[model samples]
Target: MIHAALAASALSLSFAAAAHADPIKIGFIGELSGPAAAVGQDMLDGFNLLLEEQGGKLGGHAIELIREDSQLKPDVARQAARSLVEKEKVPIITGVSFSNVMMAIHKYVTDHEVFLVGSNAGPSQIAGKQCSPYQFITSWQGDQAAEAVGKYAQEKGYKKVVVLAPNYQAGKDIVNGFKRYYKEPLADELYTSLKQMDFSSELSKVTAVEPDAVFAFFPGGMGIAFAKQYAQAGLSGKQPLLTTFVVDALSLPAIGDSAMGIISGGFWAPDFDNPQSRKFVKDFEAKYKRVPSNYAAQSYDAALLLDSAIAKVDGKVGDKPAFMAALKAADFKSVRGDFKFGNNHFPIQGMHIMEVVKDGQGRLNLKTIATPFKSYQDAYHGQCPLP
Candidate 1:
């Protein structure tokens, strides 16, 4: 019996030390195809940039990333996740882009006792009653940005406005978030197809209403299509289109001159005044030849967070308790500047009101004008099981 116990202890020690010998593998699943390809590619680039900077290492262990494309489909995301867990055997998975995809794979990842360092797509359900100890969000809740925009609109005395978003989990979250803070009945609350590119009919409805402003949440290609259509409809700046998560760095080039002077809300921009943020922006632009979007910033922070947590764990990826504690500590310097984890594993960060503007060289970009929410905790955190 004593010899058997000694053998068992020896095997456990060998398992813990194996990460030092073999590269610690992590999984990345995102919408790498379809309309949201930009979203996934930006996320991949952000994480890869960090890896290259760190010599392809995190903590004391060499890192190996296994990637899969979700194709912006729920079933595809689920299958990709299963393959990562069952085949790739990655203990940690990150780079989930859209809320619907996150929801599709959340249970599977968490049930397997694997960690999910979600870079985007924090739905209210996960933020609240369904919050998992194995889950951590580097991004804000889906509604947080939209809620800030709603507050801005309310304070600007826009009593009647039209609200529009894609018909999906994230869209519903954004609309609900906007309504939460606006505290007024909207002139029109509308939803478009999740895959719809044409906004002519929606713009027609908004023009007919002639509300004080039009508030919408259209991200990636959808935003580009909507912005072009709205501008072509002669309702962009004239009708006062207010938005969150739109007119960002990724979409600016595609949206062109139409993106200028659009009122939007965001978590970070390249023009921020922090050293870490400045360095990240400079390096990212130097490598990618484009300004990093909110998705890129958040995904970069996830990489930084993993570095800190993995280093703290000392290459023992099997040490789940220590690793979870390290992640919760959030010891890394984020590109977003100051950062920390909320009890529900969502970020407690600031949200700013911004406008799309041109630089001295006439390059379209975002400028932070007002920060209405600082160190903001999401509305659903109180409902989470965590303290």
Candidate 2:
């Protein structure tokens, strides 16, 4: 009788251990140790914060988030994806800080049937005809922000606007998208190397042209450098500098007062007056001791998206069809209120024109000025075959 009781107790303990089981693993790959580190770190923080709020579980299943640093290199990103998929065997992988890196690892993730949810850097190819059914973007296409500022420039009657960006995929996309909407004679279009720190040459051209306005799409450290140099060159006072992804919460703190009065465009900002937005901003500030950028907000939304989909399928991430269907439904509450995925797996959302303003705390922050595209969808959606 005593032996039987001991056996029964051991069986009960073993059953309880099985019931708890191991966590559902999710992989995050991004540029966590380079010029783009801030953007990647902020996104990771946002994703972790969402999981933290849910008690480290999504869909009632414990989660194990495996993170890898791509260092903003394509080869590194590919290797990271391989390790995550093969070794960690994560069902979902998200977070790509740069379009270049995203492009590098896109095929591997999608081909493996691992759901790839982009927190940032939605390159044009992934949003168009080449879009994979397994991939979804919670962020704007690389051009949407530029398009917003471009339309604003047109409406404001900026006749000759000079455009500048890094000579890369995202840079080209920004210039193209702006031209598509601005429809203005270009004063000059400048493309610099991704690592170019000295913008004196470009600024000199802008000064010579004396365009009605100047627009740029510099991200990460490039933005900080450009904004500071623009001010030092005495151009910010004379010509309005309109930008995208260059003067947000992440860059503004680094750019300081130089970012003030700079008009920028984005889909989300710290001051967006929604309950979800407010809560996210407040919680992020309290935890991170800094204001969250749109990148962070989008990453948070991505986690929530996964949570919603996982719950819908009863945490069965293995149920690919059911999980994908749940993701398409987009049942999560986004901080950027109007969030919905277009057929192309990119967001069909509004874009806001924002101006950098000094908050009461003497910090630069984005304040919404206008909603240029109240209901905007990316132009390439028609080419996407995914429904």
TM-scores of the models, in the given order?
0.95, 0.96
Candidate 1, position 161, lDDT = 92
Full-model lDDT for every candidate: 0.91, 0.91
Q: What is the per-residue lDDT of model 2 for residues 147-228, given as tens digits with 9 covering 90 to 100?
A: 9989999999999889999999999988888998898788899999987889999999999999899999898999999999
Q: List the residue pairs that clash in candidate 1.
A: none
Candidate 2, superposed: residue stretches over 4 Å from native: 1-18
- The backbone clash count of each candidate, in order, is 0, 0
CA-only RMSD, every prediction: 4.2, 2.3
Looking at candidate 1, the ten consecutive residues that score lowest on lDDT are 15-24
C-alpha positional error of residue 299 in candidate 2 after TM-score superposition, expressed in Å: 0.4
